[model samples]
Structures are given as structure tokens and as C-alpha cells.
Target: MRIATYNVNGVNGRLPVLLRWLAETRPDIVCLQELKAPSEKFPAQAIADAGYEAIWHGQKSWNGVAILSRVGTPVETRRGLPDDPDPSQSRYLEAAVAGVLVGGLYLPNGNPRPGPKFDYKLAWFDAFIAHAAELLASGAPVILAGDYNVMPTELDVYKPERWTDDALFAPEVRARYASLRAQGWTDALRHLHPGETIYTFFDYFRNAYARNAGLRIDHLLLSPALAGRLTGAGVDREARGWDKTSDHAPTWIELSEQAPRTRSASGSRPSRAAKPA
Candidate 1:
């Protein structure tokens, strides 16, 4: 299946670009982040009209997440990270599409480090790492996808030196990401195109896309079992240039149809599987 993830920036402001990409790419499942709209403000009818079913978690003028599936109803599994004791932002949403358990997350963009926001960002990452560990323990074929707001490695970002002090590139943030990956999750793009210069975000102010100077903060990480079935992966750079588009572009991976049929060590198909952004 063609599973894709995108941080649309704002659902209403970029409706046309969103629809156009949906029509052109026709991904079987899509995980959207940063809707920047409230639940009531979500344009559900408009999305449905484009031939997909959606389930979303939204907040006013800020972080939000949603999953749109073409094959099955998107059953909401969770709304926010359970470990978040003071959960106030709508940054996470989980759903089941066809049998895949997809999660859409908009991790905090903790700019201007050494501040309260940066602390919050690290706390959120800790919570996510804990939650991911729980999901991995479920022994499911999981696909955690989203704009993690993290430059995983120097290769993942252009001019890494300039971002050394940035929250996303800080040593602690990278360590957390590494800890999560150590739990058996595979960075799908890196797994397929190790060392390749692929980027999913560009700065409009700097005309970054034209210069191909961008960051690979967006990702689609899957479990080892599912990684073996990854047929291909890519970033849709054209989406960045689309009129009224978000700074972030769409990233996707194609999985072989035969992948899911393989039995796990427990001798049954995984109950939770995902391909979310």
C-alpha cells in the first residue's frame, strides 16, 4: 500500500493544495500533522468528498493530527500520548485503517533552545519514547509517522553546523531518537536509501527548495518485520512548491502486498500495524 505523511501546516488555508496532492498521489492511507484547526473547524466534508475516510484530533490554531484511509473506516484508537500527565496540545492521534494501527504526531518545534519550550520539547520526547516502547511490546507491525521536528543526523539536515544549538539537533534529542530506534523500529527512508540526500522540509524565506537545502525532519519509521517489505520510499518535493503549500512536503513508502501475510513469531498477524505520518 502507498502510505504517506505530511504536515499540511493549516488545513483550511491549504485546502486546494491538499486536495490536489490527494488527487494526484492517491495514497491508500495518509497521516496529516499540524492541521492548525479545531475539531469543529476541520473540513470533514471536503475531505470525504475527495474519496477518503478521516479521523482527527485538532486544537485551535496549533498542533493537530489526523489519518485518512481509503480502504477502511479510521477507528480512533487513542487521542494523545497517555504518559502526558498534563496533556494540553492535540499533537497525537491513533487509528486503525484496515488493520494497521497508524499514529500521526506533530512533535514540538522547540526553537530558541535553553528555554521552557525546549524543556517541554524534551519532556514530550520522553513521553513519546515511553509510549513507543509500549507499542513495540504489543508485538505489532507498527508504523510511526509524522513531522518529528528532529534532524536525526547531520546527513538528514543541510548545514548541520548552523543547527547545532537548535532543540531538534541537540545531543539529547538525537539520543532520544536513537533510544527509540534501538527498540527495533526502522527508519524506513534511511533503511531504503542509506546515505542518500533526501529532504522533506524547506524554508520559504530562504528559497531553500530551489537550492535543495532542506531538512529530513519528517519520517515514516516501521518495525523490522515491516521494513523488509518496504518496496520503495521518496519525498514529494513538488508539493513544497505548490501554491499555498506548507513548508513541509509529503514523504511516503510503498510496501509489497505480500508483506503482511507473513506470520510473526507468535504465529498470527500483528494486531496493531500502521503507516501514519
Candidate 2:
């Protein structure tokens, strides 16, 4: 199976771009971030017309997330992280698509660091880490994919010196990311293309894309069960070149046919033929 993650920027304004990509790539499952649309305006019909079933958590003019399954409707798992009794933003969404538990998130950018925004980002990361620990203990095949907004290492950024003061490249942020991965979640792209300068997002400024100056903040983290099935992983750099596209590109991973079974909520094994829904 092929699963991909993309930050749409704005679902409505970029519907055509998204549809075109779906037509060209046809990923079995896709995790989308930055919908920037309210729940009622998610364009579900347009997505269905493109031959995908989706579940989304949306907010007006800001953060949002969704999971699209080309084969079936993804079963809703959760809407937000557990500890947040009242999350005002739509940043995380989880669902079961083709037996894999997919957690799609749009982590905070935490710009202009050393302030409340930066503190909030760190707090949210802590909540995510706590929930991730629970998922790890469950032993279910899981994937945490999306724009993490943190460049985990110098290797993930271009001209590391230039971003020394940027929140995305902050040492504290990177450390938290490392702490999460240290829990056994494999960073898929890095696992497949170690030490390579693979990038998935480029700033619209400075002609970043044309200059190939980008960052690999977008990531796919696989649980131990799915990590073993990883056969290939890469960024769809061409997608970033498309007109009216999001600054981010689609990053995907492929799995072998002998993928291990995922434990379902009821403690039962999910079937291979159990198409998405």
C-alpha cells in the first residue's frame, strides 16, 4: 500500500491542484493538513468525485486535518489528542484506513520564538508525546504523518546557519522530536534515504523551490509493526513544482505485500482484503 501526506494550505482554494495530484499519483491513502476551511465547507463532494472517501477536522481560516482513502471511507478513530479537554484548534485527526491507524497532525509553527506561541507549541508536543506513548503500548500498526513543523536535524534543513534562530529549527523543538522518535517510531523517509538532503517544503520567498532550497519538516513516523513493512519512501518533489500548489509537497511510503497485521480496537486481527472502510 502507498500512503502519502500533504499540507494543502487551503482546501477550497487548492481543490483543483489537489484533484490533479490525486489523478496523477493516486495514493491509496493521504493525510492532508492546513485545510483552512470550516467543517461544513470541507468540499467533501469534490473529494468524493475524485474517487476518495475522507474524514476531516476543520477550523475556519486556519489549522485543520483530514484523511482520504481511495479504497474506502476511513473509520473515525479520534478527533484530537486526549489531554486537551477543550482544544480550540483543528490540528489533529485519526482514523483507520485499510487497517492502519493513521494520525494526521498539523503541528504548530511556533514562529517568533521565546513567547507564548513557542510555549504553546512545546506544550502541544508534550501532549502528543503522551498520547504517542499510549499508541506504542497498544501495539497496533500505526503511522503518525504530517507537517511536524520541526526540522529534527541539521540534515533536514538547508544552510543550517541561516535558521539557527528560527523556531522550526530550534534546539528545544528538535530535541522533543528526537525524544518522540526515541520511543521506537521510525522516521520513514530518513530510514530509506539516510543522510540525503531530501526536502518536502520550500518557502515561497527567495524562489526557494526554483533554487531547491527547502526543508524536510514534513514526516511519516511508523510504529514498530509497520516499520518492518517499509519497502520505499520518498518526496513527490514534482508536486511542489505544480502551479497553485502548496509550499509543501507530498511525501509517501510504500509497504511490502507481507506487511504485518494490525490489532483492531476489539483486539481482533484486521484482514488484508478489508478495503479502507
Candidate 3:
């Protein structure tokens, strides 16, 4: 199976680019973030016309998340982070596609840190950690894919020194990300291309894509059980140059059909959360 994630920026504004990418890539499952469209304006029929069944959590002109599957209707497991007591923002959605539990997220881009926005960003990460803990406890083969707005390490970002104060590169933010991964989810792409130079997002204003100066913020993190199935992983950098394209490109991974069943690092049996299609 081929699973991919892309931050479309806005579904309606980038519909053409999105459709074209879908036609060309044909991933079995696609997780989208930042739809920036209300649920009523999701253009479900248009997506259905492209041969994918989808479930979305949308908000007007802001954060949103959705999952589209070619093999089956995605079963929505959750909409927002469970422990977020006041999560008025729509930034997450979980679903099941072809037996794989997938989560799509649009983490806050808390720029100009050391302020309220930055605080919220950290709080959001905390909530995500709680949710991730629950998923890990469930023991299902889960994949958390999206634009996490985090640069895992210096190698994950271009000119790391220049982003010292950036929320994405902050030590606290990186530590929180590490804590999430420490829960037993393998960073699929990094696992395949360990310490390799891979960039997934670029600054449109600075011609960053053309210069190959980008950050590996978009990711596919698989549970330890599902990691063995990963066959190939890549960033579709070309997609970032399409007309009205998003700053983040589509990142994807392919898995073999006959891979070994995934199990916890400790050899514990797996379990799953209930989902609704």
C-alpha cells in the first residue's frame, strides 16, 4: 500500500493541483491538512469523482484535516485531540483505511515565539502526546502522518542555525516530538533514510524549493509493528512547484503486501480503537 500526506493549504484554492497530483501518484491512502474550507464547502463530490472516498474535519479559511482512500471509505476514529480541553481549533482527524489506523494533523505554526501562540503550540503538542499515548496503548498498527511543523534535527532542516528561535526548531518543541516518537512509533522516512538529506517544505517567498533549502516537517510515523512493511519512502518535491501549490510537498511511503505482522518492541499483542465509516 502507498500512503501519502500533503498540506493542500486550501482544498478549493488548490483543487486543480491536488487532483493532478492524485491522478499522477495514485496512492492507496492520502492524508490532507489545512483544507481551509468549511465542511459544507469540502467538495466531496469532486473528490469522489477522482475515485477516492474521504472523511474530513473542516473549518472556514483555516485549519482542517481529511483522509482519502482508494480502497475503502475511511472510518473516522476521532476528530480532535481527546485531551485538548479547549481545542477550538480544528487541527486533527483520525481514520482507518485498509486496516491501518491513520491520523492527519496540522500542527500550529507558532512563529515569533515566547508568546501566547507559542504557548498554545506547546499545549497542543502536549495534547497530541496524550492522544499518541492512547494509540500506542491500543497496540494497533498506526501511522501518524502530516505537517507536524517540526524539524526533528539539524539534518531535517536547511540552515538550522537560522531557525534557532523558530517554533519548529525550538529545543522544547523538538523534545516534545522526541517524546512522541519515544512512545514506540518509528519515523518511517527517517528509518529508511537515516541521517539523509530530505526536505519536505520550502519557503515560497525565497525560492527555497528551487534552491533545495527546505525542512523535513512533513512525515509518516509508523508503529514498530508496521515499520517492517515499509519498502520505499520519498518526498514528491515536484508537487511543490505546481501552480498554486502548497509550501509543503506530498511525502509518501510504499509498503509490501507480504511483510511480517507488526508487533510491539516488547512483543506485546496488538489492539485497535473502534472507528466509524
Candidate 4:
């Protein structure tokens, strides 16, 4: 199965580009971020016309997320982080598709550090990590995919020194990311390429895409149960050059078919005896 993540920036404005990519590179499952629309404005018909069924959590003008399934309707597991009882901004959506629990997140882009926004970013990370741990404990095959908004390492950015003070590259943010990984979530791209500098996002300014000066802030983290099925992972860098596209290019992974295991009636969780491909 092939799963991909793309931050559409503005889903309505980018519908055509989104449809084009959907046709050109048909991923079985897709996690979308930055919808920038209210729940009612999700363009359900257009997406349906493109042959994908979607479940989305949307907020007006910023930070929305969705999960799309090409094969069937994704059974929604949740809409927002449980830790936040009354979340006004949409930022997460989880669903089950093809037996995998997919968590789509649009992490905060805490630009100027040393402020409330930055503090919220860190707090959100903490709450997210706690929920992630809960998901891990459920023993379900899970994939957390989206624009994390945190550059985890020097290799993930074009110039480490320039980003030192930025919240995305702040030492504390990186440490939190490392802490999450220590819990056994595999960063798919890093696991596959190791030493390569792979970027999934490029700034619209300074001819960043042309210069190939980009950041790998978007990521797909796999739980231990699903990591071993990972066969390949990469970024569709060329997509960044598409007309009126989001800063983020599509990032994806391939997984070989695994032996079938007992599943719940909803096929949300695989049995413990399940083996990797």
C-alpha cells in the first residue's frame, strides 16, 4: 500500500492542483493538512469526483486536517487531540483505512520564539506525545503523518545556524521530537535514506525551490507494528514546482502486502499475531 501526506495550504484554492496530483500519483491513503476552510467548505463533491472518500476536521482560515481513502470511506477514529476538550482550531484527524490507523496532524508553526505561540507549540507537542503513547499502547498498526512544523535535526534544514533561534528548529523542539522517536516511532524517510538531505517543504521566498534550499519538516512516523512493513519512502520534490502549489511537496511511503491478521469488525486494529511484510 502507498500512503502520502501533503499540506495543501488552502484546500479550496488548490483543488485543481490537488486533483491533478491525485490522478498522477494515486496513493491508497492520503493525509492532508492546512485546509484553511470551515468544515462545511471542504469541497466534498470535488474530492468525491476525484474518487476519494474523506473525513476532515476543518476550521476557518487556518490549520485543518483530513484523511482520504481511495479504496473506501475511512472510518473516523477521532477528530481532535483528546487532551484538548474544546479545541476551536482544527489541527488533527484520525481514521482507519485498509487496516491502518492514520493520524493526520498540522502542528503549530511557532515562528518567532519566546512568546505564547511558541509555548503553545511546546504544550501541543506534549499533549500529542501523550496521545501517541496511548495509540501505541493500543497495539494498533499506526502511521502519524503530516507537517510536523519542527525541523528535527541539522540535516533537516538548509542552514542550521540560520534556524537556531527559530521555534521550528529550537533545541527544545528538536529534543521533544527525539523523545517521541525514542518511544519507538520510526521516522520513515530517515530510516530509509539515513544520510541524505531530503526536503518536503520549500519557502516561496528567496527562490528556495529553485535553489533546492528546503526543509524536511513534514514527516511520517510509524509505530513499531507498522514500521517493519515499510519498503520505501520519498518526497515528490517536483510537485513543489507545480503552479499555485503549497510550499510542501507530497511525501510518501510504500509498504509490501502483509499477511492478513484478525481484525476488529471495523478493521481498525490488527491482531497481535500479525507479522510484517
TM-score of each: 0.92, 0.92, 0.92, 0.92
| Candidates arranged by lDDT, highest first | 2, 4, 3, 1
Model 2: CA > 4 A from native: 260-277
Candidate 3 per-residue lDDT over residues 1-277, each given as its tens digit: 9899999989999999999999997989999999999899998999999999999999988998999999998999899998774567889999988989999998888787999888888999999989998888988888999989999999998899999999999999999999999989888777766656888888987778888888889988888667877777777777887878998889888777756565222331112100111
Residue pairs in candidate 1 whose N, alpha carbon or C atoms collide under 3 angstroms: 100-273, 101-273, 145-277, 146-277
Q: Encode model 1's per-residue lDDT on 181-219: one tens digit a residue.
A: 999998887776675788899898777888888889998
User: Candidate 2: deviation at residue 121, Å?
Assistant: 0.3
lDDT tens string, model 4, 10-96? 999999889999999888999999999999999999999889999999899988999999977899988889886338878889998
How many backbone clashes can be found in candidate 3? 1
Query: What TM-score would you give candidate 1 relative to the actual structure?
Result: 0.92
RMSD of each: 5.7, 7.0, 6.9, 7.0
Q: List, in order, the clash count of every candidate structure.
A: 4, 0, 1, 0
lDDT for 233 (candidate 3) = 78
Residue-level lDDT for 39 in candidate 2: 96
Best by lDDT: 2
lDDT score, candidate 3, position 33: 93
The runs of at least 3 residues in candidate 4 whose Cα sits more than 4 Å from the true structure, single-residue gaps closed, are: 259-277
Pairs that clash in candidate 4: none
In order, candidate lDDTs are 0.84, 0.87, 0.85, 0.86
